[model samples]
Target: MIKNSTKVLVLCALALSLFNCSSDDDNDRGNWIERSVFDGVPRSNVVGFVIDELGYMGTGYDGDDYLVDFWQYNIAGDYWVQKADFPGTERSSATGFALDGLGYLGTGYDGVDELTDFWSYNPGSNSWTQKADFLGGVRQAAIGFGISGTGYIGTGYDGDNDRKDFYKYDPTSDTWSELVGFGGEKRRFGTTFTIGDKVYIGTGVSNGLYKTDFWEFDPSTEVFTSKLDLDEEDDYSITRSNAVGFTVDGLGYIVSGYNGGVLNSTWEYDPGTDEWEDITGLEGYSRQDALAFSTGTRAFVLLGRSGSLYLDDNYELFPQEDYDDED
Candidate 1:
């Protein structure tokens, strides 16, 4: 009887160990490591674009005033260097993209009015030159991306109304033209990330509701193909405006945004599978309007607001690693 009781106790202990291991595996699939804090003032609605190995970020609101100070981040060195101030008016909620080795920024709110001015950044000379104004009129919180040496900007709010139109830019001629065909809803503050030749756009709020419809835009075909809804799965919670979207290791990720309130949730997208999997969220404070930089291989999120509080902290995500609170 004594030996039988001892054997039963040992089996119970083994079962308990297995249960704990399973729980940990289920809860921890990704990790976030805090990196160097942003050198700029804490701000939100900043715009950024990655060019080669460096990332350019600028133009945001620090809760008090609009900002124009521009900064360049070296991904390999993990440091930031102040660049020339944005020559445009102080603004926030602008959109930017990099193409043909040059960066372009335009369309934002400048405290008193919406702006349609566009400018291009020449990294070689470290200067910005005004380009043709956006043809879509003055808007803020629009989405922008570069594909095949051309830049595209679309969908945002004018002073009074939200928009769903898209336009393309030609750097050689410095011209803007409308590129219609997007069937998605009108939204501002939506997120987009490019994978290969296709760009995925989704999230953001329209009519005070978080948008769930996802779409893929192919520059070659100039078509907007609908993907799975963000809420396709019963467990998927991937709709939020002001989130940051980026690609790392050929996978797309959206992290930290507002949906009724600030959120720290992270969702990973597989282009081949058209599916989203929940990953470890931002280990830091939940935020919205943050900036994300991806060097094709590495990605990082930084500088945003949590409610009324502005933040300058940065974090890098390791999607396949086990979660560890300690960096």
Candidate 2:
């Protein structure tokens, strides 16, 4: 035979290594555990923000319908409740971010046309108010994030073309300003997240090729630098759109996007080594247009679409990085 014993040894060692690494820093700090996954408005291309321990998800499109309703997820009570509707025209694929306790939402296709209107919500006030427009043209399928009260939005299609332009919004001044280019190829429907002072961008389809290139941008330097590359072979290729990525502390996790159809695979990136690890595929049906954001280390995978139907299923993923107990 081809030495079945040798094969067993190799497989056992590989499994042990994964277990060790997951417990390497485990002093049993018990960081990053999911509390709940709420069933919100079942739709795709939705936008969301995390504010003061509460999470808000809203706005997206279906096959033949668009949406404007909003809902707030209560982490403490493990429940979801309807919130003030988005004041803009009902739409899908809009970008959203939170800054200084205010939730900012803007830009999306409203069935008939893409939009550029911007709006803000204050949970404290239980109301939404209009703000300056996005400055950029109407767009959907872009990513938005905030760093130190400054919001950044860009990288989506504008009508018939894809866009990579980035703009900075200052909520303090209630204004928008252009920033340096993203330094990545122009593509719509990727994923992005802000960690510390830098924002990271990753995989999306453009032209006809699926990309695994990754980059980081510094607000202080106003420049982008290539940092990491994520690649793997699976039933799902990198070819995808409406992907989702979120950050807790400085670690980033990406998952379940669509490539012609829904994708179930997921990946995580660590800036310390500029490396990515393929984690468990999402347990739910493969989907696209699901939006995710994290207040603490825990991340939630909410609703999206699979076959020909919209979904309301929510999944809670725990990135538990418990440090090892030396005792």
Candidate closest to the true structure, highest lDDT: 1
C-alpha-based local distance difference test score of model 1: 0.93
Residue 149 of model 1 has an lDDT of: 78
What are the runs in model 2 whose C-alpha is more than 4 Å off?
Answer: 1-41, 232-239, 321-327
lDDT of 2 by residue, 175-236 (tens): 99988767788888888877777788877777866667788988787789987455543432
lDDT values, one for every candidate: 0.93, 0.78
Each candidate's clash count: 0, 9
- Give the per-residue lDDT of model 1 (tens digit) for 104-168: 99999999999999999999899999999999999999999999978999999998998999999
Q: Which segments of model 1 are wrong by more than 4 Å?
A: 1-27, 38-40
TM-score of 2: 0.83
Clashing pairs in 1: none
Candidate RMSDs in Å, in order, are 2.2, 6.7
Alpha carbon lDDT at 113, candidate 1: 95
